[model samples]
Target: MNEVFDYVVIGAGSAGCVLAGRLSEDGQHQVCVLEAGGTDATPLVQCPAGLAAMSKATHLNWAMQTVPQAGLNGRCGYQPRGKVLGGSSSVNAMIYLRGQPQDYDGWAAQGNPGWAWADVKPWFLKAEHNERGADAWHGQGGPLNVADLQQPNSLSQDFVEAGVQAGFARNTDFNGGSQEGVGLYQVTQKNGERWSAAKAYLTPHWGRRNLQVRTGAQVLRIVLTTTKAGLRATGVEYVRGGVRHTVHARREVLLSAGALLSPQILMLSGIGPAAHLREVGVQPVHDLPGVGHNLHDHLDALLVADAPQLTQSFGWSATGLMHMVQGAWEWHSKRTGRLTTNFAEAGAFLKSSPEVSRPDLQLHFVVAKLIDHGRQTVWGHGFSCHVCVLRPQSRGTVRLRSADPLTLPLIDPNFLAVEDDLQRTVRGVQMARRILAQAALARHGAQELPHSACAQTPGEIAQWVRQTADTIYHPVGTCRMGHGAMDVVDSQLRVHRVLGLRVVDASIFPSIPSGNTNAPTIMVAEKAACMVLSHAEKTSVAAD
Candidate 1:
């Protein structure tokens, strides 16, 4: 190794995958990527039906839990993160959504100058390569493939029609201009397998002369060096295979450790609340108070229903083992049928009212009636519809429990704090009930199993929600971007009062996007890469 490079990216997750691949494409600058997990070597990672095992397997998942929130009825929420090459993208629901245009405009209004909706749309288009081909809204020739659903179930169509019954317009594409609609969701899948960020962007670029990939490397902290000019990010100290090493960065160090761990890494590197660092016996470098604030996530409740189709999950059959095996064979050969389905095949995004402006809720329709997040297969055939309030009003925080790197951090989602947001979610459930009562769904005679006989008042439903809602497992916004005093990064995703460093991940969102955040997180990385290259060019010119 040269002991230094133009850029060094930490964590080869979603953002790091793209950043390292794109930045080193020029071949002039050396780019090294540090990944905490091993390669995407397991078959479970590629199988659409394999997530159930992966979710339970601790091998590649951080699988951390929050430290009891008062807002969530004293419950600690589950947080499953990918500890692998693609990061959570390897294990996520694979639903592709860019979120509402207004989401970006709100960031621009929050004093993040270049983050307006207009500014980010190009990057979104630039990174997508849809299977249906190119259009004004989607790109055809790009690294990631946003393709049609491999498996389409009847319940998905019923869900769409049910949305129309619930007063939502039928939208074919959520990525299109308007997000208010009901339809089947697009996914990041190719030929019945998951096309994760590592699979799409990083895999193609592997072994490039300018790129270096290091797996099983856990970063301890960034090694900062001081010069007469200012503080420079010299390198990162990390552990791989229980051995310690250091890799230098000649230009800048970019952290793509994600929403949760990015701030934890920063705090370990001495760039967080000074008091907390001192309390943990670590000397403070900078007292940036916003390193781990603004934590937000999507809280969803999975409702059970007796649907007609009982063949939803592989965990369902005993004698049908051969059937599941045959399906897998078909998928491996041609990429079709149940084997191709990503389970939660169809979904929709919409508001409870016409004047809401942005979609306030979303639906995730499961083909098979699931029981307890697929932990136990339902004895009888059934289906599920997960309801989540998108862009929740309440904000939370993430903080360190101590200074130890292995120690889990504190995550409080602070859900249902706003009475109005609770009411909105109650209305969301009511809409879901209406959909179940529709002709298309009632034809199947679906019954709500987590049966609540309580009155339909906002108070009643909200109370039930507090008692029942579980995480859809989408967490974000820990490192907020704005011009305010509490903001950690500016619009360019550059940390305030810090040079030669940047954070490109979900943590920098000023507000939570309207829906699933993985695609938007990838888009953020795309825009960040452009900004980093722009800054590098400017820095080079100034130095010359």
Candidate 2:
């Protein structure tokens, strides 16, 4: 028999780390964090731009690919998930955005009570220590370190000006009072290094008595036992390295393995779509029909251009690989210069339609521009703007290929499946084109890339959105939380058919937040930690 834990957090991604850190602070509960991959001890995992290099490292990533998306000209889209300690936060762009207030209210309307913008606002303020100091909306005393780039790129300025010229309101801060505007992004960084979940939450408490962090430990399934009353999650069975072991949870099993894997683990433990579970050779423990139904991801394709001067555009190097190496050296020795910037420094949030109350599209401007898959960089110089429709109307599903816990689940985001998702994407492209056409960018000879759809008819633009759009890497709502019968989790984020199990990641989001999801994800964890701690305290009082 393996050891038992009070709390077994499945994945040590953004949410798991926070949960583990906060839950163990009381010195009473023993928290075991099961990460499928190893520790985030890589050299690049700390560098801001290391995300691009790390993206190609499949060994450190689960690296799941989607089924051929009809929306992207039948291309099987790529979805890279961090398999290591800090999870995707370790590998993501590190851009810190909380989305808009309306995004939360929309959740409340969908039946996730106590989760409106105002309700969750405190968590955002409570978890941040921004370089800009405290404000009405931002925090000053928080675990996470957020800051602006020391050297704002000139390309970022032009991109903002272009958007303004295109009639976008230039609001500098999205996380502030309003979000409809253009500006440079604040990132999850310290000094200039990446502030991954480990750096922010876990590392500070590594040697704590109650926190047991296990890397390279794959949790096979949640084990349950039953009394006369109902079912209870008693523990978890996991495998580490090559050895199979079982670790029991005496209190609760928290699944923070992110959107893709969390739902998969649920089904493997027999808590998903009934028919689907039986087909995959798992007896249905619960008939939660919405375990993996609401699959959505923001799609953005590169709009490349030749730059005026020598920008960091990885787009132009038959020979600049040396520069990248030298730059990495400079960053490692002293965290400054080119390596400090998280490429795509500039960004904006815009409403695709005035009728829509919240912003539907997001864009980020990158300094380096090149042609052809970032391989054939134009030597002269170039820039690219990535635009994504934040709220996708189309939904998809994630189903298990088999019952094996070791295998990756089959994921289909169904990108652009809904007409509005496609329509908004087309609008996003139009808005971007308008930005590029501005006189500011015109000074830089902003020639649009070949792939940018030049179609005048909205129908043609929509078709291009379907054909060329790609995931901007924000996927959510698989184990959807809401009021409908198909909803898997309720307002408190508890699974409909299970007791003592909660999903506290981006996966629990009913829809993708209207901006970058990293900061909002942390907020969810903060809220979840409070909810969990309160329950644990209540359970303790009862025992007394």
Candidate 3:
């Protein structure tokens, strides 16, 4: 006999934590969530400023790198994912944006019901606890905390002023009526600390007897059965403390392991393309061609500049060290100061051309001289402005490098594969240069690093883009949602040809949203929780 629960959620990530917390709220059902990573108790995960340390914390981060990208001049791109509870929400920059409303409407038009902007806004509201209080568009007293930065870096403000100086409007809320404009980002923080999904959803429910959360438990694959109805997932096989164990689900097994790993788990469970499964030595249970096909991520190019002033910018000088000590003391005492920063504090949404339907480019203004994902250290103080394409045209794949479940999956975000992607990226670089070159930022007298600002030709910009462009860490659509043959899941998030299984994470997104994905992922879990509970109620009524 095996331990059986009403629901077993794989990966206690942004979506998984929400599902575990919401589904077990009735107190009658048993819900179990398994996380591959350990607890989120470390200060590096709790403090907002710990994001800087997280960049190098290999143990806490997946730190997956892509194969050399042909579009990037064969440069290997760094992809960092949080492995601890709350998943990437615990380690990300913490900006909370629901993206453009049309992003959801576009999904509905593409054959997904109940996901349109009008239909899904409530879910977003239901999961948020905005500091500004509730409104028709925003909600308060919800699980996830959304707050304005307690103390934004001065350079961040300068970026906004520069954006305005460069002819862009100032937007107060990216999650509000419109996303177009430059402004300070509202982060997923509460009282200067990082408010990851685990903090909002899982922490409060830890005492619930019906809910069990197992950390450091790596799921190998989903257990499935061939019934008269079709393929139905029954349980999951996982490893903990070097011992293999099995847990059965009485009702459902939800996969919420994110975009890169969700599809990898599906393929490991023998549910992907039959031919590819065979190649990986996996027995085919189902032939879903779209399991890992629609892979995409927001590709970005960065512009690093030299800032001589250590008081306004972050650097490695003795004065900078003293400032850090004082900032730490301030945060420890009042939860305020530089320690509250999420690094990419200010950003914007803008269009490259009038013909573009929505903002095709987004910006992240970092108050530090970031290079190579902060892996390469610079000698002095400066700043970086990252310009990423909003909706990339190129697609890639996440494939099994081997049959072993513990083996890392091959990630190929074949960025800039489309010529237009490169062209648009060049436009984004040009836009960033325009904003950085404005009078507000120009006051710092920052000079471009590595690449000369003198290079202004289209070919020069295009070559520079190819030389430096990489991911902003928003990977999605590996298991896309739709009604088409290649679609992995339907509108309700159920696998197309499987029963009692659902992917309740970003992997199911038909297309990536326009901004940061954490908010949208939380919303997806809220909606999925309702669908699961509704189906259970209907089943009980029929059983009676």
Q: Pick the candidate with the highest TM-score.
A: 3
Candidate 3 residues 397-474, lDDT tens each?
Answer: 999998999998999999999998888888888888999999989998888985746558889988888887788989
Report the C-alpha lDDT of model 1 over 319-351, residue by residue, as the tens digit: 346667888788677767676677787777767
Which 10 consecutive positions of candidate 3 have the poorest summed lDDT? 307-316
Please provide TM-scores, in order, for all candidate models, with all chains considered together.
Answer: 0.95, 0.95, 0.98
Candidate 3 versus the native: TM-score?
0.98
Question: Lowest-lDDT window of 10 residues in candidate 2?
Answer: 370-379
Q: Candidate 1's error at 138, in angstroms?
A: 1.2
Instruction: Candidate 1: give its CA RMSD in angstroms.
Output: 2.0
Residue 255 CA displacement from its true place in model 2, Å: 0.2
Indicate whether candidate 1 or candidate 3 has the larger TM-score. 3
What is the alpha-carbon lDDT of model 2 when measured against the actual structure?
0.81
> What ordering of candidates by lDDT runs from best to worst?
3, 1, 2
Runs of candidate 2 with Cα error greater than 4 angstroms are 316-322, 370-380, 453-457
The local lDDT score (0 to 100) that residue 266 gets in candidate 1 is: 87
Q: Count the backbone clashes (under 3 Å) in each candidate.
A: 2, 6, 0
lDDT of each: 0.81, 0.81, 0.91
